[model samples]
Target: MTNIDVKDINTLTLSILEGADSYYRWIFQEIKPYLQGGILEVGCGMGHLTNWLLGEGKVLVADINKSYLQMVERRFKNHSNWMGGIVWDIQEDPPEDFPLSVHTIVCINVLEHIRDDLSILKRFYKLLPLRGRLICLVPALRWLYNPLDKGLGHFRRYSKKELCEKLTLTHFRILTLRYFNLFGAVGWFLQGTVLRKRLLSSVQVNWFNRLVSLFISIESRIPSCFGQSLIAVGEKS
Candidate 1:
């Protein structure tokens, strides 16, 4: 079983701190409707979104990193709906005790790290029951690939067509497929592609966080064809 360690914790923590609450809230709103019954969240990094998901339903937060799992366990130890954390590697066969009948599987910014993403999608299909949902988010646009993507150990960014095709090939019926954060596309291009920076400045991130509400308002009115990330919802058939 191959496991990935994108171990830039300091940068990750900074990003979470600088990120706007509205951004995560918007994402939660988008995926909330599909999150019924038992849920599993893959790559529950630093419990940023995991904290929010806990309020929605019974959620099993999983990550390959033991430290993250331990942190999540400690953070939500008192909550009844917090199903505890598990060490899960998406590239390998799930543990025998892994819950296969979960109604929803949520994966965010994780698929790009796996070289064999389609195989992982098939595994996700098997883990879910018939008509179960898979909610995923990944960086979008091949042209945006740069030093930052490489530094993050990303295999590749994805387009809407590519994501939908992969999900469809793995026996998933596409429900929602769209681009997100149109404003982010410009910043990613400038920093990652043009400037070729591998890390984001905390100051800049803080500045952007302050104006995130405005960005969300403006981008929400625009079409989803232009953005820095793709968000997809699929149902097992």
Candidate 2:
């Protein structure tokens, strides 16, 4: 296991994990179709899904953030069957040491943060072997922009059409692109636009977080509904 130097690893884990259990469940369900053999997760912050993916064969946790990568490595050292972490640079071009051949790639909530999302997509498209799958999840609704979005370093939110066009341009055939987390859209609207809260207090976030997950659970039991986030599964063709 690689060592991740951080003053407060536990706090970081707790921060991301609080509202993410539901999101991760939805993500796993959505990404199940594309996953196989060698898999790579871009921007795998704090090993949220790292431990689960490690159970599968040939799982590589790749991110540019050295600290995040180390956190994953140190946390999941017990699962050594097929586990490794790599320092990956998605901008410009993939670093030489990063895996050249991969079957499935999951890029979640990281595209908007990237300076050149399209170029990264193109490079990812080329990196995959024939018939490889790519799972991409990006924030939806450009109007929901707020200070948290800026603080998180997101360049832009994506609409369904805009995201699809970019994916198509990258030589990927969109197998599925559906909206996710509909309730969160309303939450974002209220906080991002109406109140315009820059950052969230822990208690406030936990309360809203529970509400979001509860609504998501209800939605999961029900049939279907529109969502604020867009999740797409594409294949290199």
Candidate 3:
């Protein structure tokens, strides 16, 4: 973990995440099937996910932080599939100019930052057309939450039951819902609870990244009852 203040913690975290290429590609594989038509990625953040999704479709990135939005746009503006980006606060109603052409909305590690996550899920439900998909990945296990969660501005870590219930309540028919990153869960617990670390170390992330393929292999064959994160795919029926 680098020496950083709370306000800059997100940027620091994203920087660290830049090295977790294998981990993210594991995520990309899980959600790739659901990605279709106009893809509206809710929190592009330094465009890590956006980079993988460049030529996938009409990729429109949105984020409340204008600086992050502009940075992501500038990073991929020249791509043929880059539809540009917009500054959007998911807590409020999507702007009138929000595109109706979006058939899928991808939210990665963003919902945990919201206080009323249900309201935003409802908004996403309203924003999509029939059979449109809502793909989300969020940190799991509230018991594992640590100072790292606080510094990263996470409101709460989600439970499998809670996520499913919310998606059901929001009128999204569940497609794929499951725990992910089994090894990462152990590392998170050790770092946060056992070691009592407030920030992540760059060396640790790179080490973990190198082993992500092995983790993916193990996770694929073994059905996990719990994990460090949850990936849910819900369809607006």
Candidate 4:
């Protein structure tokens, strides 16, 4: 593992894992189809998304925090598909050091932290082979940016247009790009914007998780014009 300054963990990301099983599971299912070959998951904090990707393929989990990587490595120690964890700073690290087996890169809820997201996207592009996929999920709606986003060290939230443009600029073919979790958007607005809460309590997460199935059912049929997050899959062609 590469040595670097370990920053404070993303409290917002860790808090969501408290009781949001169904919520994360839904996200996993949505992105699972795009996963192929060996996968390198960027910003794999505490292994929330990594847990789901365990059996999907060979998973090389990478994060800036050494502690988080150690935890993930310990948690999945027995799993054959676990390809070990690395301490990586995407903005600073050269892509040439990544294992050649990596064909799909899954980055969930991580891009917002970087001010130079375009540079990181180009780095991700260089880390892959032909037809390699970049499965990315990010907070959507600039209007929804609030104290909670700031607390999480997020530089900016993203619009579909903004994300698509960045991915395209990196020379990736846009494969899947759309909005996700309308219900999450509503709750986020109430807590972050209306109530001025910087974090979602475990009680709130549990309540919302219980209804995740219903939310998924409804969102699947409705036109996803807007959402709490944007999910995009780009392919290196």
Q: lDDT: which candidate is best? A: 3
- Considering summed lDDT, which 10 consecutive residues are worst modelled in model 3? 1-10
TM for every model, in the order presented, reads 0.91, 0.84, 0.95, 0.93
lDDT of each residue in 1-237, candidate 4, tens digit only: 122112332544485675687888999999989999999999998888888898798899899889888888889989988888888888886545655399999999989999999999998898789999999999999999987777667899998889999999999999889999998999889988998765566788889889999999999999999999999999999
TM-score for candidate 3:
0.95
Ranking by TM-score: 3, 4, 1, 2
Clashes of each: 0, 0, 1, 0
Please list the residue runs of candidate 3 whose C-alpha ends up more than 4 Å from where it truly belongs after superposition. Answer: 1-5
Computed on alpha carbons, the lDDT of every model, listed in order, comes to 0.82, 0.74, 0.89, 0.86
User: TM-score for model 1?
Assistant: 0.91
- Candidate 1 CA-lDDT value: 0.82
**lDDT of candidate 1 over 1-237, digit per residue (tens):** 023234673347435553656667777877888787788999987777887888988888888888877877888888877887889888998877854347899998899989999999999999888889999999999989997787678899997779988998998999888888887888888887899877665666677767877887787787767788898999988
Model 1 residue 210 lDDT? 74
**Candidates sorted by lDDT, best first:** 3, 4, 1, 2
Q: C-alpha displacement of 44 in model 2, angstroms?
A: 0.9
Candidate 1 Cα outliers beyond 4 Å, as residue runs = 1-6, 9-19, 99-101
Candidate closest to the true structure, highest TM-score:
3
The ten-residue window of minimal lDDT in model 2 covers 1-10
